[model samples]
Target: MIYKALGGDGAAATVVTAAGDARPGPAVELHDPLELLVPDTEDDYRLTVDPDTGHLGFTSTTEAPYAILKADPYLGARRKQTIPDPAFVVAHHGGPAILERTASVLGCDHRQLRHSWDSLRSQGNMTSVSVLDVLARTLDDPDGPRPGEEGLMLAIGPGVTVEAARLRRT
Candidate 1:
């Protein structure tokens, strides 16, 4: 989705699967009702819940591969602080408060975070596909980010996983 938002064909991005224990366990079945918790801290962490699908995701920088990816020079060089406008933010839209907190953390204007809400409002939560839906909505916006602009893509999943990318509009 980030590649698509950046005007790429999604060809360059590599997909790798990681092995880990993410099962909620016998005590807490995957179908059990759950609430996401995000602590107040400086860490890059986020929790998202899809009320419609009853899916809960927890992501944090402490996770090894994502942490390593965040540290990679190529990706790290494009951190939010380095972007001029902070105009594009494609993320899982768990709810209003999470979006607000994300905007604050990214130093992005609340208006820039509208795409996610628009997606959520219009389509409900689509789980892993939510970020892609948000990206599609962003692309459909007439006044959206233009070529050469920078953006961020964030997605959280069952591994308490976080997938992020920095994009340069093409």
Candidate 2:
């Protein structure tokens, strides 16, 4: 019932071409995209299909949100080694709890996640597209990242998976 209320439908389109290919427009350079599955936490959030009814269902435990903390070591190492302190963060709108947990793991305050929270409040959770929606908002925000500034993208999914990337405004 809780998950159902948070479900949202949305779509987005963006142009992507090689740096050398030459497209005349604004672009955000995305690099060093990392993805990981939190060990022993796959059941924290599950999507199952009923064999008889042929219906898809989503289930999550109370521990689902905190599972993202398990990825902190890797994320922290990346930040220390390569990624710069981002001027902004674009995170998926999983929910209030997930957003709070993500902020804790990233060592950022909730105010830094304003775009994500705005998206969640306005559109609920758009699942795979939630981060995209937040990114769109961040790009459109008047006070958003400026050219040459660095940013980070983070998202969580079933299997307690973590998807992250370093972004640069170009």
Minimum summed lDDT over a 10-residue window in model 1 is located at 25-34
TM-score leader: 2
Expressed as tens digits, the lDDT of each residue in 1-170 for candidate 2 is 65554553456677778777747544578888888887888889977778999866679887887877878887888865656567889999688988988888777777779999999999888887889889888888888888898888998888888898888887
Off by over 4 Å in 1: 1-85
In the range 1-170, model 1's lDDT, one tens digit per residue, is 32223222212222222224333311100111122222222245445467899754444454422432333333234453355355577777655655665565556675777888887788665666777777767766779767666677766544334466655444
**Which structure among the candidates has the greatest lDDT?**
2
Q: Model 2: which residue pairs collide?
A: none
Please, what is the whole-model Cα lDDT of each candidate in the order they appear?
0.53, 0.82
What's the CA error at residue 18 for candidate 1, in Å?
23
- Regions of model 2 farther than 4 Å from truth: 1-5, 21-26
* Worst window of 10 by summed lDDT in candidate 2: 1-10
lDDT (0-100) at residue 50 of candidate 2?
81
Scored by Cα lDDT, where does model 2 land? 0.82
